[model samples]
Target: MTVTHVHSIDTAPDPVRWPDIARVPSGVTARFGAPIAARLFRRAASRLDVRVALPDGTNLGSGDPRAPLMRVHRPAAFARRVAADGLIGFGEAYMAGDWDAPDPAAVLTPFAASAATLVPRALQVLRPLVLPGQPAAERNSAANTRSNISRHYDLSNELFALFLDDTMTYSSALFGEVPARWDALEAAQHRKIDRLLDEAGVGAGTRLLEIGTGWGELAVRAAQRGAHVRSVTLSSEQQELARRRVAAAGFADRVRIDLLDYRGVRGEYDAVVSVEMIEAVGFEYWPTYFETIDRVLVPGGRVALQAITMPDARMRATRGTYTWIHKYIFPGGLLPSTEALEQAAAHTALRTEGRLGFGSDYADTLRLWRERFTANADAVAGLGFDATFRRMWEFYLAYSEAGFRSGYLDVQQITLTKGGAS
Candidate 1:
């Protein structure tokens, strides 16, 4: 027998040759180690024209002039985790305290801005591979729905109330021309509802149905505009609050909020609207969702669907920082691609009338929420919630702001009218 000696890099430490490092998938391979990593780094450098204008330069690691404002960490098993699982692994690593960056938003912003960088990065992040099948769970079962909604909405209304506007609307971002005024958010939300109603062309006495109405903002606004409003939501807290608001506004008869699914809705209406709620319907249920909307919308009626949309198929499922939202904030939620939404409505009599994208505004909206939440932290904590809950919410707001800033998320208002029904 002949004995062969193999030198292990862990013991030898001669810059740890590429071959000695653990194997990683091809995607991560392009971003790690000397040769390939250097190429990728050079590409990023040239693209970003890497520059840091620091006065004292004390904020950066190593205080190296060439690497100002940049910190690099090469964890031994980091590449392996990112390569094998992509966003899921990366997120887990972040949560498990495996990775640290001084400014996550600043580090990710430049990469997000470049289309060339984003395309390849998205592909690398989304490349699919087969794995052993796990046991199937029941599809949108009642128990599942309750658990999903409760994970986030049922936490504590008082906590949400502290940060949210007076109406307690908990949907997509609100846009305003000015940033300083709190009423700007509320005004923007009402304006959004008005825009939806105008696009729907609903006149006085017209009947309207709103699916997933949060806090009755839209429903009450539509009712005030002289359109009878019927709204539905899964959250009992939302339903009760909305009901009280509607009654107080003297539109209890005109605006009705029901704690039910859209599929349970009956009667035909002149218009339909859903805001920021469609993401929770999941991709598998989009067809049913569209069908339900179409069924209750009368001939020649219009439907306005407002929800966050992914720019591409790769983003349809939550990724990176958004996985935290799925696990802790919005379990079972999935943003839909524009194509998927269009395809879901294909079988219906509806046709797209107008579309608007508000991806940038979401960044501003989230930042505002984070500031408000932080400002009112003491009051929110007084609502009998633990520190973990507060931290969870803070993390939620910060991570969401990061996502919107990165353009990995979007908010879209899609207007649809029944086709061939004029």
Candidate 2:
């Protein structure tokens, strides 16, 4: 794909100055914090397996010849960014071309692996002075949820199509092997969806409620299983494409796509299925999310949920903090731990029946996505997204891939049953 015209980068300016997205600490705070952050980063890097190369011909970390190499282009800027916003600034620095790596994911994995202990316990207490809380405007309230969803999902349907597999599934795919091939991605996605459908017991004449309609692939699959489906999403772009895809697949009669919030969904169903949707619901609303599902799910019905989960300690620690992801990728999102999900369900009639985690598969999936995205950079640029936007997207994908690669993040297909079914 080629571009006839490029949109102004000014339209999507760098988010470094976005106070709601990332807070630049006061001069006094930065004066003290920058040196502290630089020292801590150097100390942390010295122990990691990777190598960090500075412009002054100095290298940190173990200097393992086989380890990934992180090259810092503008050290002072990088230090100040990290001091100002922590991880969020780290990402912004990447977007601003302050640092780079031959393989960004490879360089990020070790850091993600040591996420819990990167800063000393004493220094971690200073996090509140640097990091900002989740912006109230980005919260998952009934009204704000739509805007939050629009920010990412509604960017452009065509933009997503450029990178995703033919199945158009955005969530993780369940690959059959460790190193999955690109040609098998569509099949892997189908397999993942099939597992969810099977766990939900969706079959002939069954009524299904899907909380997130991602380009309608899942809905079509459910309809193919002889289930009547109602799918809801906050993205108009996704809804439009999903509706067209459903009609094209001849499942339009069996599926109904609605531009509605999950909280506003008003029907009882045999099965309730949501894939990676719970993350968009803020931590404070998790109970409400499960309660809504409980209210709509009939007794004896199954709820198959695909969720991206982090460790409980990590979730609790970061739930209220704004990060790079919140700034440039997904806003108002928080990954729940397995324990947290179960606790949320405890407040409702839903009980966990089973759970299967495929974090490695997600890592593989994201690697493929990142590769494809880079390969299609021109196409992405042709879609009018500027260079900074491209860098942000690349960093977001690499950052996420590294999380899964290091086991800092995980994806789980969890089965829940109404009325405490065993």
Candidate 3:
């Protein structure tokens, strides 16, 4: 039976939902702890332009009307979240209906802009005292990688299709200098993929290695150019769909989509490409990741990496903080700084050829995704995902977009060459 179908509109799986209701509470800590944490939040935002409104109609901040407003419906719950989970509680509070921000991105923008200065110098030194430890199980060890990847990637494909464009490119789409319409999303995604391919110098007879096979667009596109591509991924759901897409596009012979982790991948190739996959490599494993690429690539082989990056100082500050994103969205992920990449490259068999940051493009991409997701909220809930899940995703997308909007984060496509340039 030949399966050449492209896009099948399949119903989502009714997977077991979140809110581990079985877990036991730690102690009476949250009872008294939440209020103290709420006061700290008030103190932190006191100088920021944004206002955090209380139940009594009083607010915290500089009282700037131009700034975004956050309504705390249940300060106790919001504070309890922060007190117990630290950063994770912030987003959880929203899911629990403790807070409301009509424009999350807008409200978050000011906070994101002031992220570097949120804690004063005197207080920053006490961060170890204030912050919670990263979950030991969330660490991206060889044994634990697949579980971490599955928790997010293995979530129903139909859920993603509900919001993503026809191309199904989940990462940032480079919509170019001028703001493009929603219709240009698929094309923008192609542009982004094509740019990475072009930078990697993929063409006929070029043996390409893609570290993270998201779906099959990149593999199919590369194969269309007569390149033989071998893409690797750990996501079972992603691999199944990617392989199906590859077969559908008649690229089964040219493109091999393997369910293999980067740690175990074998073979040397002419070009290596990984789109926004480096974030999952973990800070401790960065060197080994680069080394793996170095070992797999032939001499003069080109490498193009599309990565989400944060400022060095911010990365330093939040690297160890178990945030909401780690808990609910992308587990075991950490955005690296440009300097971190350069520092790692300086010691590896790779040298940077070129780098392009498209943080604004990501902001636009996320905005469109959020809008689309919001528009299809009913359909999403119909897919067996609860309201809490929808709001969690909404916050994830908006929070990410805000990070880019505030220039606190960026997405860069860096081109590198083995043993320097050819």
RMSD per candidate (Å) reads 10.9, 4.0, 6.2
Runs of candidate 1 with Cα error greater than 4 angstroms are 1-143, 173-176, 180-183, 316-322
* Candidate numbers, best TM-score first, in rank order: 2, 3, 1
- List, residue by residue over 90-122, the lDDT tens digit for candidate 2: 987777667888788888899999999998888
| TM-score (C-alpha) between model 3 and the true structure | 0.91
Off by over 4 Å in 3: 1-29, 62-66, 420-422
What lDDT score belongs to each candidate, Candidate 1 first?
0.63, 0.86, 0.82
Query: TM-score winner among the candidates?
Result: 2
lDDT by residue (tens digit), candidate 1, 63-144: 3443313333434344444444444334433333233334334444454455335325644444433111111232344446
TM-scores for candidates 1 onward, in order: 0.74, 0.93, 0.91
Backbone collisions counted per model: 0, 0, 0
lDDT tens digits by residue: candidate 3, 320-346: 887788878888889999998888777
The alpha-carbon lDDT assigned to residue 29 of candidate 1 equals 47
For model 3, the local distance difference test gives 0.82
Model 3, position 256: C-alpha lDDT score: 92
What does the lDDT come to for candidate 1? Answer: 0.63
